[model samples]
Target: MTDTALVVGGTRFIGRHTVSDLLANGYDVGMLNRGNHENPFADDGRVTHIEGDRTDERDLRAAKLSTEPDVVIDCVAYHPRDVETAVDVFGDVDGYVYVSSGSSYAEEAIPKREGETPLRPCTPEQATDESGETYGNRKAEGDRVAFAAAEAGVNAMAVRPCVVYGPHDYTERLDYWIDRVLTHDRVVVPGDGQNLWHRAYVEDVASALRTVAERGEPGAAYNVGDRRALTLAETVETVAEAAGTECEAVPASADALAAGGLDPDDFPLYREYPHLLDTCALAALGWESTPVDEAMARTVADHRESDRDGNEWDPGRDAEERVLGVKETL
Candidate 1:
């Protein structure tokens, strides 16, 4: 029997890659989304695009998405309500894989291990806030809800991935550095650029999701990311090398960047503390991730090929350049 999988938000980024992996693995795939984005898999006959709002129970029922799928890969279930609606609608499936964020973990020791620290759960009000200050907590609540559904007979697991980069990255987090390195002689490094960062390749994340769908334990959460962590300076160097460009790293204080109108939140890797995640559980599942250098190369190449329209630069680049210029003056 051919396994059938339903991918929520399947037209972009990790979700897009996951759908491609499912199709390549011989799984008959169905995608649920609002149909506003361009469909990359429109020509693939094996994929059935189910246009519906994931939040609306009526849309889900109308699309018949709840009926007996072998697996459900939810890439956008960020809130507790999203998880609850999925469990309430999809009742039972052989496997349910939730694409969660590593941010769901409360601040813990470096190289944070799964199950070592309690997750921070957000209140309903906090989850609905638009400022995104409670994003991690809200995702934690979603994970909790998924686990609760597992207790109610839904076989579900959550995969927490650190910063995901590579092809089809709409956020342009990695691309920000790539563009700057390619276009500028000097790039600003926030906070000494020594904070260790961990990220996962989008393809690796997709593979991890497929692995969880196939063999993951119910109610389990796995942290999936690169085996090694790189500092922000090292990351910029990697991108520069990949792009075959030479650029100097100019150290800038976070306060200085903020003074120049660059939000600290905008630069995720430039943090005061290291954001490392231990992926031993994922490795123990017999999965290996792409090396950071190789993934960076592929990401830079892809960005150059597909995103060369020159609009991917950060909107605050002028402010950042002004800050760097002032530091040069000093």
Candidate 2:
């Protein structure tokens, strides 16, 4: 009956923001990570941080049993194996919340609805594989782990978030667009540039997570995304307008791709037209996104002031040209 929560990847991106929100909300918080990045929070003493790798068995044993937590929210899992390790270690914890990705569903066929969603497939065996890693496929595996582990004995819930951004954002994917627009320079778009991208703010995501840990229905997965939708072109134009500047977007070119450090052959950008997530699934948890204008301004200010050096980002999440599939040179 201890009132405590453990968060993995508590110093980076979504994890860091979730920790801050948890502290503000008066929950006893413990953060688990490898301590590879800068610490984002001041020592409030209410929050305890344990540094270690999620992939390490020693760390897992320590994370689950050391706290005897009331709830555990994992923020750093990419493979399902990581999930099994957590379940094994947290023998008899009360509540569990695993942050999964919406990409756990096939990019080509997720219905944009409120009542339910079709989950992508994953095998039980891969759920514990140490070497499997791909965004969508691995997430599918991780989902199985969280879902199955939740079914075994704990009050468990999974939250799937898409395209999270905000102040302290590490990759500055939004920053790339904002920077180019602020410079009054053309931002690059891959093709017809009409693909929609789902958006979620980091703090809002954290709030949803905390709520999920407390009130979310066990053995269920909720899509935590916003109704607000933006196509690549629309966002570029909107940002340019907001920045009080005029810029243009050109179709990405092979030479431009090569110059931007893409092979123009292997890592082709492949964005599907995105759909709005059915956040009604999360409405019961009292989740909400920050206002777009305010979020944008805050992000602009952070990057301008360099207050987000330690934010987490994927390999090329910042590059506007990712998903274009730049084929590797033979």
Q: What is the total number of backbone clashes in candidate 2?
A: 18
Candidate 1 scores a C-alpha RMSD against the true structure in Å of 2.6
For all the candidates, what are their Cα RMSDs to the real structure?
A: 2.6, 5.9
Candidate 2, residues 1-330, lDDT tens digits: the string is: 237888888887899888888878877888888888988764678777788888898987787667667778889877777777777676466667788887777644445542245556666555545563556667766677776777787677788887887777776677766665666365466555676667787888899898888888877788776556667777777667656678785556556555556432222222655555777878876777776666666666666776433223222434544423342232
Clashes (N, CA, C under 3 Å) per candidate:
0, 18
Instruction: Tell me the deviation in Å of residue 114 in model 1.
Output: 1.8
Name model 2 segments beyond 4 Å from true: 110-117, 123-133, 241-270, 307-330
lDDT of all predictions: 0.83, 0.69
Number of the top TM-score candidate? 1
TM-scores across all candidates? Answer: 0.90, 0.79
Score candidate 2 by TM-score against the native.
Answer: 0.79
